[model samples]
Target: MLSIMFYIAITAEAMTAALAAGRRNMDWFGVCLIACVTALGGGTTRDMFLAHYPLYWVANPYVLLLVCGAALLTVAIARLVDRLRWPFLLLDALGLVVFTIVGCNIGMEAGVHPIIVIVAGMVTGIVGGILRDVLCNDIPLVFQGELYATVSIVTGVVYYLGLLAGLPADIVVLIALAVGFPLRVAALVFKWEMPRFVFDREMRK
Candidate 1:
């Protein structure tokens, strides 16, 4: 189940990256590069933090191939993506749920503290988008104007609680997805966002 969800998550992330590349009018190579970064960056960050050797994609070379193929396919269908905006949003939400669950599971299995486990989940869910945005010279969505990272933290907490309650692994994953996906989609659809804190420079005096 984790394997399947991981594949789906990477594919969805690649497609989202592809769309971002399209928006920038990037060529095929740029598209592939962005897609790879967006698809793998989060998991890579998580693995490094955990001191897990031979990163996920490096261990499973096929996963890299899969992401590359998905990116190329997305480029082929680039013209229709704008028209399918809602589906793209839904896919991105699904990716967030899957990655958060996977990351939390890894942290828990590694015997990390609960807070660290949840933070791992958030890093897994948001770092990819942050890397993509940075590469594109845009502010990462997790940092502003959205409830993006908040949803990841929510998913992580839900998953951690499920573990504390001794729920089965599959049930825990289902609960996280059920709760997180809708919350993320709602935020996207309703333009929900965390209130930004603005600092007044004159106050420094």
Candidate 2:
């Protein structure tokens, strides 16, 4: 079940990223590149940090084809996708939580400390979006005072504790999704944002 959601989340991330590439007027190849980066960059980073050999996409090369295929399909149906903005936003939120859970699982498997596990989850959840925004020449959304990374952290904590409590793994996944997904949706719906520290003064020459 987790693997299935992972694939769906990857496809959704690629499609949304392809739309972002289109907004920047990137060519087809550029679109596919952005899609691949956005869909897989986070997991790649996590694996590298953990020194986990045979990165996920490298082990399953078909996933690259999956990302690129979804991207090109989005290109063909860009207008339809644009019209379904809310659905895509929900999918993106889902991707964040699912990716975080998967990363946390990997960290646990690597015998890392608990703190590192949560951080691993966070890196997986937000780094891909950060990379996408950077490539699109925008400030990364995770650094934009949104509730993004916080949601990932909260989800990871819940998932890890649930597992530590000896809950069934499947139930833990569902519980994490339940907690994280609605928190993100509420953040979006309510326009919730972290307070900013503004420093607008210019130094005298």
**Whole-model Cα lDDT of every candidate shown, in order:** 0.89, 0.95
Model 2, clash count? 0
TM-score list, all predictions: 0.93, 0.97
Please provide, for model 1 over 51-123, each residue's C-alpha lDDT reduced to its tens digit, 9 standing for 90 to 100: 8768888898888888989999988887786678788788889889889888887788778889989988998
| Candidate 1: residue 53 lDDT (0-100) | 69
Candidate 1 TM-score, C-alpha based: 0.93
Off by over 4 Å in 1: 200-205
Measured by TM-score, the strongest candidate is 2
lDDT of 2 at 63: 98
Residue 29 lDDT (model 1) = 92
